[model samples]
Target: MERTLVLCKPDAVQRGLVGQILTRFEQKGLKLVGMKLRQFPKELLEQHYSDHKERPFFPSLVGFMGSGPVVAMALEGIDAIAVVRGLMGKTNAREAAPGTIRGDLGMSFSNNLVHGSDSAESAAKELALFFPGADELVDWTPCTLEWSYSVGEELKG
Candidate 1:
């Protein structure tokens, strides 16, 4: 199983959409290995969004993210990073597909409701930023794994 980080952004939390966002992943057969609700510190936000520091939306982006509690989740499944991204749809809510989380619940570009790591490298870095301790993540097999993947498939972490 591959693991990836997913965040229910402040807007999602504020709008009470965290449950629905999480359910979408769960129902997709992804296993939740770790999760927390937190009001992140500005320093952490800065580090997390460091790549966007040169972008125009950097300040407000960090501000909005730190404004309230956000749900950080570590999910595991086959190609979990890509899977989560597909569930989240495009970053700009207005352009997201109708069946996606953003398309269904969001309207603004800046206030898009969720975030998911886009690649293996990003997943590692973002997961570390959100879940630093080795003990923070749990390892377990979901009973539905067999049903989710083929009998001949190889499962890995």
Candidate 2:
């Protein structure tokens, strides 16, 4: 199984969309192994967005992220990284597909409602940033797992 980190940004939390956002993942069959809501401190944001530190938008990005609380989650499933990203839609809300979360609710690129790790490597790093000691994440097998993912050549029940 793959694991990914998902962040319902401050915009989503402030707008009361945390449940809606989480519901999309749950309905898509991803397992929520860990979750929490917390304010993003500048130091944490620096590590979380280290790749973009030199970019011009880094300051604004950090400031905005630290402005409010965010819902951080660790999701596990087959292709969880890509699946979560797809559910979040394009980074630019205006360009997101109609059925996606950003397309349906986000109004701006900077204030995009959600953030999903872009790749497995990044997922591990991001998961560590938001959820230290990831080993503690739950390993419960969802009763509906059989319906959500294939097991070898067949579905498991």
Screening candidate 2 with a backbone cut-off below 3 angstroms (N, C-alpha, C), the clashing residue pairs are: none
- Backbone clashes counted, model 2: 0
Candidate 2, residues 63-137, lDDT tens digits: the string is 999999999999998889989999999999999999899999987989999989999999988988888874757
- TM-score of every prediction relative to native: 0.96, 0.94
Report the Cα lDDT for residue 99, model 1.
Answer: 91
Model 1 — which ten-residue stretch has the worst lDDT? Answer: 148-157
Q: Model-by-model lDDT, in order?
A: 0.93, 0.90
RMSD of each: 1.4, 1.9
Relative to the unseen true structure, what is the C-alpha lDDT of residue 24 in candidate 1, on a scale of 0 to 100? 96
Q: In model 1, where do residues sit more than 4 Å from their true spots?
A: none
Give every collision pair in model 1: 1-156
Q: Stretches of candidate 2 above 4 Å error? A: 134-136, 152-157
Compared to the true structure, candidate 2 yields what TM-score?
Answer: 0.94
lDDT of 1 by residue, 10-110 (tens): 99999999999999999999999999999989999999999999999899999999999999999998889989999999989999999999999999898
